[model samples]
Target: MSYASIGKRLLGLAAIGLLTAGLSGPAFAQKTIKIGNVEPLSGPSASVGVQGKQAREMAVEEINKNGGIKSLGGAKLELVYADSKSDPTVGVTETERLINTEKVQLMTGCWNSAVTYPATQVAERYGVPFVVPVAVRDTITERGFKYVFRIAAKDSWWVRDQFRFLKDMQDETGVKLKTMALVFENGDWGTGFAEKWRALAKKDGYELVLDEPYPSTASDLTPVVTKLKAANPDIVMLVSNAADAILITNTMAEMKVKPKVTVASGGGHADPKFLENAGKNALYLFDEVEWNTDVNKPGAKETNAAFKAKYGYDLTGESVDAYVAMYVIADALERAASTDPEKVRAALAATKLSTGPAMICSYDSIEFDESGQNKNAGIVIVQVADVNGQLDRVTVWPKNARRAGYTPVFPANK
Candidate 1:
């Protein structure tokens, strides 16, 4: 072979080798950012948690499709989920694992407050930013943790929305309000809920008829039902999780002691599966939610459709909020110029971002006061409207209710 030909062949070989390495770059060299989660995967709250996972995955999927987090310089997202199984200890253990083993810098959250309370403490101890999506209890933030930030409004917001709706119900229906009976499951979510509801009942000039907390694992609440029925209140409300909501509704059906209205405060619509299972019995069942963009002014339908197309299901607030929250965190991470705990906290505190279904001010200016609570947050009010396949979920009260937020009915002082 000619010397010139040999030189050309060697040059071609070198070019080919360089091209191969460049082509294999992302597969071998891309950075992976791990985001941790501990949520119910096997218990009654599983539906809610699963939906959140789906939504978060969908968001990460979409973002990755668009070249991933800008600051990560194309690093892909990795979500590590620990099925908490609706247990607090499991949640704590998962948090520890995520922090120590996985070395994840951020966490989404567990859906149940029982799970969230303990999991949040772990985040506090580790100084990881936990972006809470749907769990309510104000205590999550009351502990003064710097790393904990709840985009989802707390229980106080929902309780307040319920009061506003109750007042409106009286004004609209002309039903003179008299008695209120509060029922809830025995858990963190239930504990905070019952306390807030009782306080509201006192402030609203309503006689407290039945105030009770039943075991969350109770198979049959017939005994609780009997006592609540005996009170004979003009109105009844449950501040329990999804399972209890279904059970209470079923028991109410069995006892045939229908009150003027039955409401499920915050835990009412956590899962679409439960809502579907509740069936006709769930009709007129009022629920307070932290996010739902149905009544949103604009862009909500597009975002909801995008999520539906990605996940192959109708998106609820739980999923939508988490998906948006990921973006919120990502945005803040970019804005603050660093993911350091303190810097991230400061950016989150100064967040005035907006999302698709931000009826609860998820899109408004997000500034946490010293208490770490977003002041401009709102909630969505959803009423199960199925009268045996005749009607679907309907929004009756606030013509423009966006956040399913609770209107104030408590702490007459506030």
Candidate 2:
């Protein structure tokens, strides 16, 4: 009851409170960094989105196992998955939820360009760092949003490289491709790519015989193929997702509508499910893709093997892009050394990943430019080749990027 004794008791309580607060401060600072992954987990584009989710998860696991963001006191990455359901509206809603409700600092994995376009808008409004893994519509990066970064080649790049591949084919094998037909789904991705390709085809002196756009979820593509057959183009270029890609190929076979050359502008063509659905029909189908397993990039084989072991399927271009995006985010987080969105955004702007997991894609390196586009990223053309009764994707374009000992079977040969 003495005044001195009461004062001593108060001092002891204050010292204990300070000690407890000090101990919890570092524990709070070591909290996991929440990374949002928005994908179409259940819809027409579910396959692509699911693969992205898997790859993102694998990357997060690997980063955590390897000490995570070491600069952040070894803070582990916590991935929050939100299904866009392959719908643009739903994608925006989910992205907003991830940023506002889930409170994720960074986000990646919008497989469909349609989904990515709107989802990124939400991210920009909230000032969150949105890293696009697979979406390639040029406008995604052209928007001038500082928080948005795309690691894949844009639509314009893919179209230009596709024309370059055609010219290479003509020069190498003397296979003249004069006219081309374009068929694509009527969505942001398909329509945007088709329009770019049309311009590029004209620029390259190729006549656009048939330009057709169909619904993305169309059940049949017979009429489209019939139109393409009537046009009788020397080359048939398709901009479709996985389901539409298979449907068009099957319809073409059924109607006996064949072209001298068949090329796909990536999208669904680069998906593993495309091969599974098209089977031998996919042979000689050249596609301009962001990444291919055949490329002789360092760690590609190891990454593919690990992917197959975990997912029970070959790693598709989207999967690889998403996986690399995860590393890019991890790299940014490490450099930022904080989970603050602004710091992460700044770190992303200063990214210069060249030799490591971040360089697993076909790109020589990863570096974001003024518009948040990876300037070093490039596209490669790959042809589906039939080898010993089995189908294999063979890189055929950009001689330096092509896989050795792999020859493309021209349409004439097919």
Candidate 3:
């Protein structure tokens, strides 16, 4: 070979080597932010957990499609899900595994307060940024943990909204609520709601005729319903999960235990499955919900339409809350511009989302307080309404958020 040909060959080989390194450098440097998502996927709370997972998946998909955290060079979010089996201890164990074994930097969820309460402790101990979606126990954010954040309305908000709705009913319809009976599941979620309601009831000058707490796993609620029937209070306020909600509604209908007002402080009461299981029996039942599909909130209708089109069912409060949680985390990640847990925590604390898809909640905005609770978080009252021969969830209280021309048929006239 000629000297000129040999020099050209050498130059070509060097260029090829440099090009290979350039092509491989960015690919090797790219990072994926792993977020741990813990929920009860196989136990009593499986339905809610499943919906939450779907919401998270949808949010992550959307974020990725929109270029996946623009500040981080398009680093995609990788979700690591662990099933709590609807057990608190299991939730804690799964969370630990996700952090230690899976090496996830941030974490979200365990739908039930029982699971979230303990699971969040695990996240706190690990210094992982934990964002709670649907768990409403006030104590979840009261633990003085810097890494934990709750973006959903707490138990006190729900109970207070229930009273506000009661007052509205009396003022607008001349329905005097003299006495109330409290029946709740014996768990962190239920107990927190019951305690808040008790305090609010006293302050609001409402008489409490009966206070009952039952096991969440009980197969039948007849005993509790029997006691409630005997009390025959003017209003029966129940805090229960989906299964128990169905059982209570069925027992009440069968025994003809009718009250002037039957209210449920969210939890299972607001779940779409409750209506599916209770059918017409669910009519006239009032519920205090963090997010309702029928509410007049910005981006709610479009979001619900997309959710229904994708999932083939109406979006519930639990699902939407989880969806919002994902957005909050993505927002924080984008602001932090780094995967460092502490930086993400700080960014989350500084988050202020108002009037956008991220503000899909009932609240006007998303801003966490010192206690890691969303200060702007609020609840609205919704009632099962029959519209065009179909039972629909309709916002009926807080005149500002209520659907126009929709009147709640109290006492259901069944």
Candidate 4:
């Protein structure tokens, strides 16, 4: 046979095998659920996607080991993922593939807000019950789509809180940060963050000395760093994901243009690479994030420890968010007691969630109010400091010594 024919034959055999396993007997029929994942498995945010993918699969394994979703009579989870390539247009197409071709009952993911916005549109078109774990664009939930649900806090929630905390620092520490400089990538996520910061800085009585938005593909940010240095602001805040975050930090240090502190608003710096990339300069670089398993307590403590033991490294906002997202998806499936999309929608809409590191979680139950946004969830800010050259999250709010407040999580600060 020709090589093409042989390849086709192998593909046919694999399909047959999958079908046989799925159908084999009535027992299997009673317990099978397909989940579709849309994440940036390639491109600038690929590292974030890979981490999320690992955590999600691990969550499914744990759930299945415990007999899957009991409400669905031990319905096993089958996950299907596609790379969004970090492109919004591609996201829409991937969503169609998962829904039309894969025929998934429930869907989750698309980490970047830009990708999430367009992909969720696809979910609503097909009437699929979509649960978003990590996307944080304000507009994602603002559209009022009934079938879409966000279990994570929007970017607005976190950025707004960070501004409030900055004001708080000025009041408490007597650090009158007069001139402020802003540096961010020119993308949907970066644009959203820059506009919010601009408005808030002016409103809060800080001089917006400089604002520069770079393209995501900028070969080097030295020119941007030079502009920021000449402007000489009290603080410089950066907003970008993964590789870009490290690149900016490295340039800032190389140019010897360290502000009082460089605050970054993304989980990008929460990874080990931040320290590994910038060495000593990584210290005092602030970051605002969703959840930290290091602060895990009670149930979360055990879960985080188990995760570290299993994964051979620590977890980040991406990993933690994906892990919990998996459980929430399972919970929704269990509550629905059926894989029918309509029933799953009802279950997800009626969900009330409580998870590890309860302090960082939402007190309110899972319910999309109008815009399909999480009723609970909030963002947390961190100052990365090296303790003997290892990066760690240093608390900046409630004095870093105090950890109680009226702030929210799940859909935090709102």
Candidate 5:
């Protein structure tokens, strides 16, 4: 069936779920629960932020159409948006405005880790529940804030898995990788990943050929790529945003800097536009992500098809997390049965969601720990390849999760 039809079918199933849940009263339309969303709507990170926004809109539409909040007489969720412009100061102000002015009952977003770090602080201070979907900076959940909950794997986990994938691939291919390079955008997210990469590289006994961090907004990444070429490490690890991701990939290709292995941490690298713009340049690059279109989950393909039908692009890891965050919020609200902040916070803390649309994630379940981190959160590695003449991401690590019939090119340079 076509993706559009599949999306329609999913909506039909959601309606069935609503009926099963005993949703019946038209009075539910009388109340609308406001969810504050702070995002980088028009800045360097805007592309990713907009992707998150679209994903949330899709989830919210499904929920409202099906039943709204059944326990609250089916009250629909209304998203209130504030553009952070990828600025921390703007994030802080927008978050406060959403709470005090817009009067949102709960909150989400500010995809940039730097913005999310402080914006979540504002949510915690005001006692509003903030459900983070994609910001991976470990510190976001480590601050002991009761109101902040993260749905994605932390940067530490991401880094850990990156190294694991590298090791597993080496073992399987009999390729001995010795030297490594770390190149990332100089941001909270990138810096955080770099810190972990440094320790892991040392622990694994790999030589550090080069370590460089560049501005995400830099117009020219040729200098960094030049350094990378000179260092010529066996493996090159990167952390970049959308625009810079394209620039770096193209620049590396242009400069003929082909490392034995090129790995990306999935910010801009996972963006659909990254694939479109980077094209063949991104071929054979490995990226760590929470979800992929080819993931083994049941509903993943249909959901991605629907999202692509609507948005004209496949869902990225960032968008998938944002999509799941809405369901998490809905589940909490369903249990809480009220917009009361404390009750919602409590319900969120007790989340053990294992079914429904949210299960479309690569992981089997969603549950938070004491730190408000999703303890069940996991990551997967995918390589860019040509499937049926289309450049696409194919899951290629962890043995079982690897896409069938496709052998990965470990060292594409040779």
Candidate 6:
């Protein structure tokens, strides 16, 4: 070949070499997979939102520390956050921004059911995978959306277990509960629980002395408490957000509106701030949760201890769900071996995560049903009691999972 021809051929070969290197470089270089999180970090539900954010941060740190997404060239998971302020409209807009602007591959959160309901719809419209950690409205997963997956038990399941616990405790303690009062925040989450509570109470032949719904952002719940006092219910069931929970609990104590049994449907009741703010007034209050500090699962205590050390408070049920969600996302990305939304969705759909750090959940396995709901998700009832001289949430129901030496104080008001 002539010198000119040889030079041209060499140039072509060099071009091909550069193209190949460009293709293979990304395969070797560390990459980041952005997971968008839309949470209520500013408004009424800020406490729960902050808890979820912290939990996700802790989980991502652990995953990165342990070698992130080994299937994706050790790509680390990066959480991108947008504060929904517990508003549905803000949640929808933030989700769009995360997907279109931030280029996140997956999505999670918006703790309030009002926010999560519409937020998941936006994710569904975009064909992005959304993993919901603890929005308990039943209809969230019931919309036939393939991209949405929830890790916590829905409100119906929560209500079912609440009634079951009441029956089981009644059977064990031989103290009957007849009239029930249903007081919940006027939101998607609270209304969902109230609907189920009504159906279950009627079926169980319990009279509903009061059915009241108040705004979560109400500056004063004294009126609600006063109504509850007048109702004089044997069992008082409450569904509230953080601020409202504290207000109602303290107001009840101030008014001395003690019922035979007071039950709370997690949410604000499970918030650490509620216990801290309500103090002894919240004692003997039965609340439903996905997991507790004293749970029987492996890694439960250690993980909670680590979280408490880091955040200055123990992990709540809402936070634990968010923590486990990171592991589930990592597991999905590992199985999918790619960051493609469809691949990640498929992997999430086929997930059967029964082991690893995520097993700290009360359920043995994490599997999604046709509706994208965690089929094995379970709930537990815990009573706020004095443990070691400090108010602590002690698991009490399900007989088998009750704390080793603590018997629940049923009929809290005698």
**TM-score against truth, every candidate:** 0.84, 0.91, 0.91, 0.89, 0.93, 0.92
Rank the models by lDDT, top first. Answer: 5, 6, 3, 2, 4, 1
TM-score (C-alpha, index-matched) for candidate 2: 0.91
RMSD to the native, candidate 4? 4.9
lDDT of 6 by residue, 1-414 (tens): 799999999999999999998998677657989999999899888888999999999999999999999988899999999999988889999999999998999999988999899999999999999999999899999999999999999889899999999999999999999999999999998889999999999999899999999998888889999999999999999999989999999999999999999999998999989988999999999999998888888899899889989999998888989999999999999999999899999999999999998989998999999999999998889999998898989999888988999999988988
Candidate 2 per-residue lDDT over residues 39-156, each given as its tens digit = 9898778888888888888988999999989999888999999888888898888888888898888888687888999889889989999999878889998888989999888888
Question: What tens digits encode model 4's per-residue C-alpha lDDT throughout 215-290?
Answer: 7667888889899889988878788777878888888789888676567787567665666777776766667776
Better of 1 and 6 by lDDT: 6
| Worst 10-residue lDDT window, candidate 3 | 405-414
lDDT of each: 0.73, 0.86, 0.86, 0.75, 0.93, 0.93
Better of 4 and 6 by TM-score: 6
RMSD of each: 9.3, 8.7, 9.1, 4.9, 9.4, 9.1
Q: Write candidate 1's Cα lDDT for 275-383 as tens digits.
A: 6666766666677665554545465677778767776666776676677677767777767666577787788777776542333332455556676666666665666
Q: Estimate the TM-score for candidate 6.
A: 0.92
- Alpha carbon deviation, residue 83, candidate 1 (Å): 1.2
Model 4 regions lying over 4 Å from their true place: 1-30, 355-368, 400-414
Candidate 3 — which residues are off by over 4 angstroms?
1-30, 411-414
**lDDT per residue as tens, model 3, 292-348:** 887667788898898889988777877888988888999999999998889999999
The clash count for each model shown is 16, 0, 0, 12, 0, 0
Off by over 4 Å in 2: 1-30, 412-414
- How accurate locally is residue 129 in candidate 4, as Cα lDDT from 0 to 100? 85
Model 1 residue runs over 4 Å out of place are: 1-27, 268-270, 310-312, 355-365, 386-390, 399-414
Badly placed stretches (over 4 Å) of model 6 are 1-29
